[model samples]
Target: LPKTSNREAQKIVLRIKRKCRETESEEVAVSIGIGVATKTEPEQSIDQVLKEADNEMYQNKLSESRSTKSKIVQSLLNTLTAKSNETKEHAVRMTKLAFDFGEKLGLSNSQQHRLSLLATLHDIGKTTIPEEILKKPGKLTDKEWEIIKDHPERGYKIASSSQEFAVVADDIYAHHERWDGSGYPGKLKGENIPYLARIISIIDAYDVMTHDRPYKNAISKEEALAEIEKCAGSQFDPELAEKFIKMMSA
Candidate 1:
């Protein structure tokens, strides 16, 4: 193949990748490697070219596997968002806010990364709830409330089931735990709760308060912030909530 043909092949591969991103199941990761044997290189056998291309493709696949796993998880989150009242945009906003809070708190790069994932998938377990129960506009009965509260544990199970998400499993499980040991499946208090989970709790609540839900109208941002501040000591880590508020204000 000529140099022009090689360029054309590369262009075609890139086009395929671009198309994958635009596709509805855009989370798919595509890898392509092309090797050309030129007539000018008579000493190079077709087998050698094929072997080189295969090796490059293998390396590409290895590198892309991590990205592929991330995309698949994101796709799952998208499915959850679509099924529930929560929109994909809400997840995106929360991820950004969580990452910002993590950075402001001087968390490590890896911790911030985990926080981003936790923020997106914190409510993923809600998928297990019946659609009618999830979308019910009226107050929940004790049994329905109990079922809804089980989502954290269910989310933990889902996250832990996959190696890619296992890092954030505990965070997802404890996201609903309270600072005063009054909340959720574990009733964890203070530093007993995962720090990332604590951060997520504050941000998640704020997002919920400020966003419209099937059962309620959206509140003002000021009102939402006030509610978060009011719940700081009881529902959220006070110090982290303070820092989060400061970050948002900034």
Candidate 2:
């Protein structure tokens, strides 16, 4: 093919790949390769050009696989935000607070990134709850509360389903865990709980307390902070809660 035509073909192929990433469709696994050699180059073998294009396409496929998982997780979170009573603004606020707390604790950059993602998607499992149960304007029955408590495990399964998210799965699973071995699912205590999970637990609770819910009035920020302090060493990790309070104050 002519060089101009070859360039145009490459553009089209690249555009398709971009669309695959945007849509995050299952068809992304289908690899397509295009090799174009200048019609004027009689010496260049078609086989060599084909091999080069195939190799490039293979590399792109590998990259897309990694990006695909991230896109899927992100799409799930978007759906959760849209469907649940939890507003996207709440997720954004919690993420910022968690990130800031992680930074104040001197966590590594990678740790902070993971904490941020966990905070943003921590309540994603709530999407699995029935709308009637989730949006009930009154108090929940024991059975309904039991069903609601299963969200952390459900979230863990969703996150761990992808290799890219497996690292954070435990954190998601244990976000509700208490420091005194009283929390649900695993009831992991102290350092036994994933560190990021503990951090998220404190921030998540604080956010919920400060924000108005359908069932409860929003408390003052000071009252929320005081409530968090009151729960330190029981519902929360004492040290982390203290550090988080300080970060919020600062």
Candidate 3:
């Protein structure tokens, strides 16, 4: 322990974790959180050293928890991304657009963070849908369209499954809701729709309009903006649609 630096201590902890995983059984998953605290002076009491180590250990545990949750969330995203490259790219573009729009709307840091997550995971439920339906080149039949419409509820369930995603679960569920209460999966109308979900709804429409899909060709940004403007009161929140248009136009 005399010559051990923090780096060496971390290395030891990692080795222990590796060994634990190596020997873990199906019935017993292995995991550990460790911390290192060095005594810089011989005069430091044993109690003080122990307290420091304890604090570090608690911090390490929290870090591990966050890291594990993130891995679980990323794995879901990976699954979604593997199924559809367009969805992956759409999420990336929507995240930036959502974050930027949130800032423009003067959303709090936490609100913006949640908006980003909502944008990224909004279509995750599509992972469960058949690839043929997702990438179909022609118009969907009523049944296929019904299956497509179920994604918001499906996404809500998926997002709700993990603590990491629980914060945005409602937003994901309501993302497809329209301003006039015509949307499915609850038909939430106006401000009854969650604010973040409202933002996502606009962003989702805009992104879809401007991007090519197997079923439809991409429209010009100007044309998309006009369509958004036309649907301002019915399909989208009027004020938000106006603001989004201005933001994109700028």
Candidate 4:
């Protein structure tokens, strides 16, 4: 106990981490944050040593949380990409537009980060949809349309399953909600929809309109912007849609 080196302490921590992971349950993965402090001075009080270790442990916890969120998000994206390359590319494009719009609208850094995640992962539920239905060349039947509309709920459940993704779960669920309360899963109207979800709705509609999909050909940027303007206060939030139109028109 008197001569333990930092290197040896780190080795011990790694061993513990590995063991924790190895013992993880199939349904829930195990993660740990560890902190180690060495007594470099004979005069150091036990209280001081404990305090230092506690501080280190807190910092490690924050770092571990961020790392875990990143890994889970990446895994979801990979799974989504495997299901549909078009959707993945759409997410990439949407993320850039989302950040730019967030900056223009003066959203806080944390809000912007949340918006970005929703932008990319909002359609994660589509991974559960049948491929033929998702890529149908023509209009869907009423039953198929209902099936498609169920994606938001599906996405919400997937996001809610992980602590890291739970932050955006509500937004993912409400992204399709209409300003007029006509949108799916919940007929949440006006300000009842989550703010980030509102932001996503406007941007997502714009992106989808301007891009070619199996069901529809791409429209011009001008048309897309106009459609956004027309849908304001109905399909999209009037204030947010106005801002989006101006941002794209600029």
Which candidate ranks first by lDDT, i.e. highest?
3
Cα lDDT of model 2 by residue, 1-250, tens digit = 3455666777877797677546544322333343434333777787777777677777776775566566666666766666664657788898888877887899998998899888877776776787777768788999999998999999998788667787789899999999999999898999999989999999889888998776788999899899999999999999988988887887
lDDT of 3 by residue, 1-250 (tens): 6688868887888888899768755334455677778777879987897798889889988877665655556666777777789999999999999988999999999998999999989998887799889889999999999999999999898777677888999999999999999997999999999999999999999999999998999999999999999999898999999999999999
- TM-scores across all candidates? 0.70, 0.73, 0.74, 0.73
Ten consecutive residues with minimal summed lDDT in candidate 4?
Answer: 23-32
TM-score, candidate number 3: 0.74
Candidate 2 matches the true fold with a TM-score of 0.73
In model 3, the clashing pairs are none
Which residue window of length 10 is worst by lDDT in model 2?
Answer: 26-35
lDDT, candidate 1, 1-250, per-residue tens: 4454656766766786677666645434454433333333768887787777677777776666666666666666766776774656678889988877887889998988899988778888876788888778888899999999999999898787667898999999999999999999999999999988999999988898888887778999888888888998999899988887887777
Collision pairs in model 4:
none
For each of the candidates, give the backbone clash count. 0, 0, 0, 0
134-185 per-residue lDDT for model 4 (tens digits) = 8798989999999999999999987887677888999999999999999989
- Please rank every candidate by lDDT, starting with the best: 3, 4, 1, 2
RMSD, model 1, all Cα superposed?
6.5
Count of clashing pairs, candidate 2: 0
Better of 1 and 4 by lDDT: 4
- Runs in model 1 deviating more than 4 A are 1-76
True lDDT of residue 49, candidate 2: 72
